[model samples]
Target: MGKKSKKGQSRGGNSQKKTGQKAGSGGNKKKSTAAAAAKAAKAAVAKNTPPPSPEKAPVVPEAVKEEAQNGAVAEPVPAVEPAEDSKPTADDSGLSEGVEASLVLFTESQQTLIKNLCSPPSNQAHLFDHWRKPSGVVSPSSEATNNVKRKFVAQLESMDASYPDGGLVGYISNAKTLLANSKSGVNPLEGWKPSVPTGQMFDKIDEEFEKVEKVGLNEVTSCGFVLVAGGLGERLGYGDIKIGLPTEMATETSYIQFYIETILAYQSKGDKKLPLCIMTSGDTNDRTVKLLKENNYFGMDEDQITIVQQGSGVPALEDNDAHIALDPHDRYKILSKPHGHGDIHALLYSKGVAKKWLGDGIKWMIFFQDTNGLAFHTLPLALGVSVKFDLAMNSIAVPRKAKQAIGGITRLENEKGEQRTINVEYNQLDPLLRSSGFPNGDVNDEKTGFSPFPGNINQLLFKLEPYSAALEKTKGIMPEFVNPKYKDAEKTVFKKPTRLECMMQDFPTVLEGEEAKKVGFTSIASDLCFSPVKNATKDGVALQKNGTHPGVAASGEADQYAAVRKIMQSIGCDITDAKPATYSGITIVPGPEIVLKPSFVSCPADYKVKFPNPSSIKISARSSLVINGSGVVIESLDLDGALVIDCEEGASGVISDLVVKNDGWKKVRDGSRDNEIIRMRGYHLD
Candidate 1:
């Protein structure tokens, strides 16, 4: 056993280094065969079904290694294709590197066996000549089941060091154990567990109906809004505030203007304009504020818009305080990458932002991404639903039609036996389980009878107090890190797969047992869910000038145009042909009175002309030049690509539509001795 352990570790190490090492390259073939038989026997015993004698174990075929290696570079094998009526298989082209190998290598036979076990009698393969259990564990008593549970726990703990980080086998096995023995009173479902049916996870429309009958919208005084504009806009290979990307509907509104307008829409649903805040990073602060003033704060009254810094931190594994260590270049390049947005909880609380909002009577905080303009900003339907369910955390779920996308919330057992909502990303689902058509498998435990939910949308609303408690608990418990796959662009062959340290689920961590029970989450299917704008063109594949319908328009909608469209639709305007003019910069007021005039001003448009609300403003041009003036207009320039505008208080300027190969270091030469805020914007061809 010791020898086999060392051999397994050595193989894993080698596999980690070689980009495409053949599985059969080394002469450890004999050892692996012996180990597989032994491990399979042990697993069978542990599962308490049957055990196989040495003679009955599958013969160690020398050709197996050759076949395994061939499989490495083999063309897609359709022989083992999932049964048509079994389960829907997600198109797995988007799977990250190493996940499949790490998962499949450890349990290939088990997966095959499980498939056979569940197969219809007609499709049954020859049964394995094996025994069910070496020992009996038939007792139904909690004590007896606990004894079995302990053995399983021990097995898991023992394998942690050998398996790759975030191995799915360990996760699944643990889940199974929790389900099996969870009938004991220790289960969370019977207590403060949030995923409990009556707790955090409530029926959406049903709950709202109750709330409407009770409290009513007029009595619902609390509102919350979260702004997630912290990521760098480098996906387009541009080094500027992606939030500042300019796109105009037929009305000519900018992205920033659009996002603010959406918030105002939410405010309009309630009594007053809600307290709004922006989560800014070091890379985007100066430009974010400049744009804020440029558009008259999106018609936000003074003191309503607040800016909070999302302070940087070190990665969980790095054991350092700084999350990003700059590169050698003076340009301040990114290092280990930003800690996942899960870290945002710590940022909000530690920075006192949460306390500030709570003191201001804000009971709920809606956390959403900035690039998703279509995020159902603040619909009465959603808010009312939230209040009715009394959900601690509520998310909006869209259909999971794409296999490449992350899996939504599903019920998973914590250390304590209660079922709770734990987010499983796309890669986390069992390939076999997902392929088996049980997207939401029989997650229920015979013991605890506690089953949570599946599929968690990124759009979340949490009550401030419970959220604060969860955030406090999360600090001591680092969530399991799922190392996803990404293209290693720096390698000689860019196609090679590399590990990305980010966790896409990005849900808050909870202490593995009953402590996690306090965090309940619910989901609802809503077409008004937010969609991300990632590219610059309107093929619905990239970012562009118009807004996307909830599921319509795959790409090209500027955030502003999208937000305006939502408001127009919310207020009963037929948005079918209400295209915001190109750069029709928007100014939002919760009231229905303010109307915006359409404009077709080009890039380098003046800040004042686009937004007449603020008497003063500043201007910063990312690429093309800007001229101060009454109304903004973009003059023809030698460069053209994408442009971002950064402006200051009490000032307006004109921008030009020019795509500069580079943001040239040109001198403004305007001799002015004023502490006026001079903002900067950038232009690039993405």
Candidate 2:
């Protein structure tokens, strides 16, 4: 919560090799001033994980792997045969002659730092001492393996001055848990009872929603927004950052722009400009920053947005000793992996952003994932639920399909026998249910025809003070687990070095008694707010044929357009289906393409006010309307083709009494062309 007074001096890289290599790689300087290095090295353990490559997910060391939202992990791998190449390449002699041979992989400066911190008589020596495998005689590991112990020592000593020594101890404890989970094959839901959690459910945008939205509108000025966008859009067929993609082609507004606009729009309705914190990984950090800088922070103040990067290079662990794993291709490189989005909490806390928001008088923090256009549409009502219920934590959820890929919001008893309503991981949900006496195991409710356990989209609302309190208790680090695939039943060697992972959605686990009671969910209609852009066009088609939901850009865009049309029809407009368009072997439902700019109309109440029952508005098949501008009002209009009305926020728009019907932007599916939007979403407009 205080200033990181030592970061500047500490971040300057303690040694020559570390000069430009960010401090996390265990680069502490002189022994006389070695404490800071110990702190910096600690960063490699908690901040994030995954290797230099393995862009998707760091392969878990266990047969079973844990996956985070926005990404998938491979299925259980078979017991691997020890490949000749993967074995450690020892030096000519399999014994350490001196510090030079043992610490060959380290820079001279790093070697010295390790010695000063873990040499005999130093209390921290145990950290290095544990890296050894002592037989009858103190036999040194193979020269190559000696370097691993040297790495272990340097990693432990490289913590920052700001990180308490206690924090380093905490990470070690987590590493032990990772070892236990790897051996036991972690069932995170062990000893827990799973059942539906109680919360408010909004079936539609009715009077109740409008009433709650009013409360949310007032609360907007006091809230902070956190966006989890640590991954790219490769799965969605976009080669760049997913958040940079457009929500819909109507105005072709980039997701980032819309998010900023939505925040500002709500701010304008309330009092002050709220802060936005985006969590990024090594993959998306530079581009995300460049995007904000290039677009002038999307019309918001530069300081209003804070971009924090997750430490992607987490050192992988190989066994129960909490030994740092070596890379298959290169032993010098400690196999780093992504720590999952759960790193956001620790990043926010370690970087002091969460505390800063608290200082700014922000009472609430609303968290959402990137590339979901409908999330903000229902955010106001959801925020209202948080305020009205005085909730400590509110997860915005949707009715889930049986055995869906998504995690379910369930009330469960943890290992401590404490009850917390949280998102139970999808993999663990069914098994836990079946083990707990539910025959069908995570099936749909008979009456509702949907899973009783609400679907989690990773969108959440937190009452700031309590959330911060919880973060501080854990030093902002989530309880992380390591997944290591083993080569045999003995669990002696790894199939592949694995990484540590935690879920940001696992926050409720950090809470105690009554604070846990305050954790709940706000279930909203899926059609209104649950469209996620996740898969690529080909993958979508493949998934569809296999009876899976094709959560690709095409479907996301279609859902957005459908949401806009449904909202219009509910108000007063006569909206009907357009001719069906098929792309990538999947048939997009018949519907007019409509893009509603939040500036024009955000909530159901706003749309109802602009167009009453007698307003007389009808949008025909193939009509595409793009509307923007806060002052835009349509009292009467009829369109059969593309209609674009764009203006400054307070300027005139496509006003009332208009009848325009002409050939609009043509929908073209030319595969050879270079239209990014069409190519990514499987349809183009020329």
- The global C-alpha lDDT for each of the candidates, from Candidate 1 onward, is 0.39, 0.69
Residues 29-131, candidate 2: write the lDDT tens digits. Answer: 1331354334444553575532232122222222122221113322222112112222123223222223323455576766655454333222233223223
Q: Which stretches of candidate 2 lie over 4 Å from their true place?
A: 1-95, 98-173, 185-187, 414-417, 434-441, 486-493, 613-615, 652-654
TM-score of each: 0.44, 0.76
Across 481-534, the per-residue lDDT of candidate 1 in tens digits comes to 322222333322212211122332344344334433434444433323445655
Off by over 4 Å in 1: 1-221, 237-239, 268-273, 294-296, 311-334, 377-379, 402-404, 431-455, 473-508, 511-527, 536-686
- Candidate 1, lDDT over the whole model: 0.39
Candidate 2 C-alpha error for residue 402, in Å:
3.6
**lDDT measured at residue 671 in model 1 versus the true structure, 0 to 100:** 15
Model 1 is weakest, by summed lDDT over 10 consecutive residues, at: 675-684
